[model samples]
Target: MRVDDFDFELPPERIALRPASPRDAARMLVADTRGLRDRVVRELPEILRAGDCLVFNDTRVIPARLEGRRGDAAISATLHKREGPRRWRAFIRNARRLRDGDTIAFGGEVQAVAADRAADGSFALDFAGDEPVEILLERAGSMPLPPYIASRRPTDARDARDYQTMFAREAGAVAAPTAALHFTPELMAELDAAGIAHETLTLHVGAGTFLPVKAEDTDDHVMHAEWGRIDAATADRLNAVRRDGGRVIAVGTTSLRLIESAAGADDVIRPFEGDTDIFITPGYRFRGVDGLMTNFHLPRSTLFMLVSALMGLERMQAVYAHAIAGDYRFYSYGDASLLLPA
Candidate 1:
């Protein structure tokens, strides 16, 4: 499909600078088979069935944004993926200033030797230090906020907590699964009391998630690979839920994509772990996820295309139109959407 099919005009004011105080206080727009409905994040449990299960991404957001220098030039690097115990693939700001075998000094904390630049412009940096890379990062790294937000304002201490979801535990992702950001402990308890089951899988969201679909057509877009995992116990339970007439509700596109990747042609989910470059588009069939809870996405973004695939493109267009008019927030720190397709 032409990428233009997913384009829509969004007012600048629709972008949210901060999330709602309680997280669950954020507004939610539900797009289902019946029609669109205005709601709040706190009311999620009331919208679904008792037997339905919510699949969550447990991958934690790492403090991946780093400010450093190579000799006299200032350099900025956002670690996208861990290559090894001491090496990482990073997207550098002043990449032109770097060369293979140059040392980029992070600070007094540590230094990394740049080598092996990827075709995407990201470079592999192997750290030289006795301390673990995580420790060095703790001293030198800042939250890797999305460009839409970071360009507006600098990342502050608040982002250290705000950008991380309550479900964040396993540390690997450079970007948080923004859709899961709306969830709160209270909301989870409510879902439990309401007989709504929830399970977790890990999908280390990469900074590549921020890359634009520069391709004119969906067919030409190259989706970046992201690491993900699903354990056998969780997989068996999820398959059982579906077999017992329940629905699988993916809390974010990350979990949705990973689950779909792990599902067989028979629609039975299995244990899986590794990289997934599953770029969801309108024509792709969704076998694992029955519903999705996600954030408002950018115009002509891969995320928007995924939602359009779930609930027809025309319907999502209308849903987004309503959301914008209703003053609902947008982007990584925006309002939420609960999408249910028939």
Candidate 2:
């Protein structure tokens, strides 16, 4: 299909600069077999069935955005993927001034040597230190906010806390699974009392999530690989849930993609590890997840295409129209939607 098929106009003011206070106070647009319903995130326990399971991405957002200099020229890089213990692939801002073997010095004695520039303009940055690269990032890096939000305002201390979910533990992701940002301890307690089970997996969200679909056709767009993991125990439990007639609802696209990646033709999920560049579009069959809870996405984005695949393209178009008319927030720091297809 033509990429233009997914396009829509969004007002600039609709973008959320800050997350809702108390997290669970954010608005939620629920789209199901019945119809669209406007609700708040705190009411999730009431909205979802008791037998449903919410799979969350527990991958923590690393401080991946770095500002440094090489010979008086300022350069910015956002580390997207880990190539090795000390090597990372990063998208650089000042590529015109950089070349292979140039050492860029970041503050606090952190520096990296750039090499092997890819056709996509990313570089393999090998850090110059014996200390762990995580430590180097701690001294020199800031949270990698989505370009839409960062373009409007600067990243700050507040994002350090706000961007991460309560389930964040294993660190690697450059971007937070924003849908889970609405979840709080109180909300979890309510969900527990309501008998709605929750599980976690890891998918280190990369900066590629922020990239736009420049392709004229969906077939031409290539998704960037992101590392993810699902162990045997989790897979067994998820299969058991479905085996017992429970629904497996993924809390974010990250979780959904991994689940679908691990599922067989028979719809049984299995253990998985390593990189996944799964590009979900309309007409795709969803085998693993019954429903999805995700943030409002950008126009013509792969995420929108993924949602269109879950629900019908016509239905999601209507869903977005409803969301926009209702003044729902958009993007990473924005409001969320629950999509359950009939």
Best by lDDT: 2
Q: What lDDT does the true structure give each of the candidates?
A: 0.92, 0.95
The TM-score of predicted model 1 comes to 0.98
User: Backbone clashes in each candidate structure, one number apiece?
Assistant: 0, 0
User: What range of 10 consecutive residues in model 2 has the weakest lDDT sum?
Assistant: 237-246
> Candidate 1 clash total?
0
What digit string (tens of lDDT, one per residue) describes model 2 on residues 143-239?
9999999998999999999999999999999999999999999999999999999999999999999988999999999899999999999999999
| Model 1 lowest lDDT segment of ten | 103-112
| Model 2: lDDT to the true structure | 0.95
Model 1, CA-based lDDT: 0.92
Tens digits of lDDT, candidate 1, 1-342: 999999999998899989998999999998887788899999988999999999999998888888998999998999998889999999999899999999988865579999999888889989897898888888889899999999999999999999999999999999999989998999999999999999999999999988988999999999888889999999999999999999999998899999999998888899999999998898788888899999999999999999999998989999999999999999999999999988
User: Which segments of model 2 are wrong by more than 4 Å?
Assistant: none
